[model samples]
Target: MPAFDPCYTLIVLAGGQGSRMGGCDKGMLTLGQQTFAELLVHRLRCSAAAFNPGYGPVLISANRNQQDYGRIGAQVCADLRPDFQGPLAGLEAALSRASPDLPAVIVPCDMPLLPDNLPAGLLRSVMADQRSVAVLHDGHRRQHLCLALWPQSALFSIRQRLDENQRSVAGWLAGQLVADVTFSEESVGALPFACNINRTSDLAQLPG
Candidate 1:
């Protein structure tokens, strides 16, 4: 394994309009005792630690509730435009604030149960394959938002996509050379950690 890179940045995507949750900020929604953003911070810290002693700062991409998200103990950044363009826009904003030479792990705030080995797993694939992007695959489908990492060099591609009004993340990934890092059921547990809470009904299904 390559020496752990401490410059890897973590970008927690919380900038969506939350149209499905009755227009509420999903990141602020309570998952048991903690808010989604809070849960992600706690989990991500553990994941990063397992990979390296010192990683780069966590950046929360949020459009509303900036101050509240900041209270979660992470640097907060808003999208370049305020119309809630989607996660890609938030990703672009976060990338701009991060160091251009290093890689960044992008995740949705709603998927707080991300595997503890996420950072290390993504980095390993990225280095081994020498690809600009890598994401977790849950044996069946690509967990694009739960865990995805890319070198800042791909920021230009993201910008070009946004300029063309192409907001589909899958479409963007399809255009790039991507590595799929598959996590077995035993490794991530019986319940996939990539699962996300998208609607109020989904809350009732959250693992306790």
Candidate 2:
């Protein structure tokens, strides 16, 4: 087995309008008292500290709300694409900022209930296989485009796809040697991290 490398980057995509939540900023919505984005950053930071201590870095891709997210200590960046294309745009922007040699684990801002051991699992899988990309699968279907481990070699292809206006993450991964780390639903349960608060009704279901 290949020894795990502890020098990977974590990038969180947080630039969405949250139109499904009645035009609210999904990241700013409060789950308990703290905003969703704040809680996510805290969880990610904790997860990184515990699993990949002294790793590359943790960055957040913010849109017009860069200042608002900057207060949370994440290296804030703006999408270079003309419009808010989607999470892929954010990932591309993050790739440009990160060290090309270091791998990156990307997560979405709305998945507050992300499994605690995600980083470790992803690292293990990536090290075992020299694949350029991998993501999490829950047996049924893929999770949001939230979880992805990308290598530097992918930057060129990603940028080329963007230039061709192909913003679908699934399509991008289909062209790569992608691996899926499967998780049992029983182990994860119906947590908010996996459950995205897209609509008002979804937010209402959050644990009080």
Candidate 3:
């Protein structure tokens, strides 16, 4: 609903070690017709068009299968610190590799059911008063650090956090001026923008 700059890079977070998912790259897991990373990019592209038809290309943050992720036709980047630093590090890597000309939208590859209007809505909040960050809050909780839109200004601050080893995504976000947009608890029978497949059982349950 909020107007925003159409040009922005989408950063798909897939660099985690996936400790809960048996130490495998969750993004490589298949659901429906393709891998999670591939499917995420597809859905994001479709969703982004509703907000900005000129939305910049997508980038995937992964520690493994860079070539495979790259095969998805997205710029593939890895975490700055190779010790599995978590999603914040993935976000940091994305910023480091992204062009400074546009803001970056960050989403997790595990979340295949992200809402269509999310990127646009978050962009509107950040672009409105020129805030550095904007995040989402489902009726139950704040998705916080991951599902958000950030301006070019966040690069340095994020770099600083990484420099000082501040790897807590929530902590870093707590220190910044962030705006929150709430969404309905669910859409139909599913959690809109919140269906993250984190376990083997989850992957097995994906809708056909």
**Which lDDT tens digits does candidate 1 get at residues 35-78?**
98988777665345445545567789998899998887788999
Q: Tens digit of lDDT per residue, candidate 2, span 1-208? A: 8544456777888877666776666777787788777777676553445555455577888886778787876788789977679888888888888866666777787776776567666666666665646677867777746554654767888898999999998888888877787765643334534676677776666777
- The candidate with the higher TM-score, 1 or 2, is 1
Please report the TM-score between candidate 2 and the true structure: 0.86
Give the TM-score (vs. native) of candidate 1: 0.87
- Candidate 3 has a TM-score of 0.87
lDDT of each: 0.77, 0.72, 0.75
Clashing pairs in 3: none
lDDT of 1: 0.77
- The weakest ten consecutive residues by lDDT in model 3 span 184-193
| Candidate 1 Cα deviation (angstroms), residue 206 | 1.7
Model 2 CA RMSD to the hidden true structure, in angstroms = 3.1
Candidate 3: how large is its RMSD? 3.0
Residue-level lDDT tens digits of model 3 in 19-100: 8888999888886679988877776653454565455778898999999998888888888787888888888888888777
